[model samples]
Target: MYGNQWSTDGVVVARNGPSLVSYRFILKRSDDGKLFKCEAFDSEGESILESSVILEVFYIPKISFSPKQTLTVKENEQAQLICINDGNDQNATTIWKRQRTSTIVQNNCVLNFKNVKRTDAGLYTCIVDTKVGVYEDNARVIVLYAPTIDIEYFPSTKTMKCIPRGIPDSYMFKDWEHTTEYNDHLRFLATTKEGNNATLTIPQNVNKKDNNRERGIYICRASNNISSIDGTFAMQKYNLNLPGKPHFVSSTENTQYGIYLETTEIKIKFVSVPENTNYVVYKNGIKFTDYNESVLRNTKIIDTMYGKNVSVKGNILSLFVKLYTSEDFCWYKIAVKNVVGCSNYSIKLFSASLPGIPQILRAVPKQTEIAVLWNPGFHGGYHRWFIIEYRKVGDIYWSNQTTNSPNSTVIGGLQPVTIYLIRMFSRNRIHDSKRTEEILIQTGNVLMQ
Candidate 1:
């Protein structure tokens, strides 16, 4: 122990015997130095032994907000935040940071903002340095402002989105209401919140329960401890007035036609539509205007081999041909469009100048021959006859037969249990049509007697 200069307060000393001694004292703030010492003397009072020890203390750093306890400021106004620290170390540092961003707003003890905006509204933290370690405390900086709303509607999805902007971006604390003035109550379909923005969505469908309501409007009211704001927007539904696509019903002449020197018109029927809706006719994907007017309006003969006409009346669309040419031989497409939009084209309509392929009705295998029934399509331009050709499946040359009747035919001298290929073509004085696709048939075996 030190000499009599050492204070007796909070200090104790004990001696058990001639060679044992102990000293104790409570550590204090001023005792944080290495100057404390103990000494023992012999009978001569000379310095026998001496010792010294240093004292140190550890503690948690104290942190505090400078301006006030409840920190609230108006939006777009000047503001400041000061972090006051009370500790033993004078070289300690202070930092200020916001919740959403990692950018350190201030490194010193004070943070200053010229104009505080709504984005600055959030939990702010003040960090203080201490001898043991760094410590942090949080304080809320609330910026108050009126709510703003931006609305967008998508027609195809039938959805409307309303985005609300304000302080305290929480959907639970806000009141979302949708209504129509025509005594119809609308529904808030869904709500989503991300970052500082909250969005409310509603469907664009009309309320069938209320007959007079055609539109819906959304209103949102939001509030924080500082202030309250409200926003509203009206929703509209887009209407499409275009009619559906037109379809081919029945044609005066079937899709295929026979080649004839005489002028003939083909009358066709189409699916009906709204009388006011206009239709655009296309030939092989090309607009009908590309052809001569006479070819599209009414039939007029220019020469023995040339002219064409196309016309539309109510639900019936017709095509007139005075001569056969490639321009008049193709498909037709009809589409309808109105104030709203255009509809897709109907199915294609085929027109051919040559004889159409023949269809087989029935084939009867007999004892010595096979009886086949058929029908000829268009004969080009005349009541031309078809040349029926058939042969065994492996035969290179086809057996031929002529028929003015065009419906049924029989081939004799065919072996039983044999397969044959049959095809036919129409012929006239001007041109010969291509052969039709081949049909296959097998002959039956003879019955046992």
Candidate 2:
């Protein structure tokens, strides 16, 4: 097979088969050309195949722009623009132009806009031209300026509001505020609302130095992907209100003596200005050291013994009396005092009964006498002496005697081998008491003289 010959400075962009031998080809012409026919031949130079294929040649020039859209600059600032073309031929040329310009400002593609003005904001395009084709692209450019801030102060609540201007939705507000040690304490709260506005609340509590100093400065900052804004505010002077004083109240109870003369639990009540102020309880005109938080909250003291013969005092000036006794006639008096105001109150504890009589000692039997001993009974407001009576076993009549000692007494004239029953009792001014248990005595087997 045979075909017409076509030629130019061309290169194979792609190929198939190994070792660059027995290969197929994808060719591109350095310069544009008209379609032509081609033929396939064997290594022997013989035409093995023939076909008419379109010989299309093209040059797709690639174009790119850096810092695409939205350029951020400070007030009265400058900026730079860059463009590039990655086409096969280095002879390709680039052109840069702004939206409203027919003539290209920079034919080199890299454009620099120095000392940029607000009017410089617009879309910019870059064009690349090769021997085969032309390519172009456009990018939007935005210029950003610094923002302003306004702060409002609320004196009564000690709060301030910070409003930022010129900050867009893509931007974020940042805090960079601080208060000196000698200055008032400040706290911050921030919120965002409609219209892309951010509000920051700052509360400052007046301190000693704040009263003397006329004002202070607080710094705040806002930032976005494009640029940043910083501002400061001067705080005004103001007075601080003080809290109110707490009130004190009082109550009391009777006193008592001994280990357990009175009930341990004592109740007291009070009122205050705040209504729910805390109260401290005291004991015996002193603070109750053993007071537990749980007991105070519950208003009941459990298992705690106000010591014997002691008084309970409360912070509110209430009193509690503790009572303990070993004697039937012993008595106690209780006094309570408020802890805060030192107010005093009192209550009495009393008990009445004949003192317990000593247990009678058993009698010792003798040949002609039987002896017994007992301590005298405690007679508080009662009779002093006790009567002793005895009767022989099987006898209906009793022989009576009297003694005042808490010591032993002997009965004579008793016959040997005789059994007797003896008993004793006391009669107080208040009442006659029952007799003690009768004692059984038997005489020894000895002759009586």
Q: In angstroms, how far off is 78's CA in candidate 1?
A: 2.8
Best by lDDT: 1
TM-score of each: 0.33, 0.28
Taking the tens digit of each residue's C-alpha lDDT, what string does model 2 give over 79-194?
77778666666677888788767978788877777777556667887878887777888766666544455665565554545555542334455553432222333433354342
| Candidate number with greatest TM-score | 1
lDDT of each: 0.56, 0.50
**Candidate 1 — which residues are off by over 4 angstroms?**
1-58, 67-70, 99-102, 152-163, 169-338, 341-449
lDDT of 2: 0.50
Which pairs clash in model 1? 258-380, 258-381, 259-380, 259-381, 260-381, 295-308, 295-309, 296-310
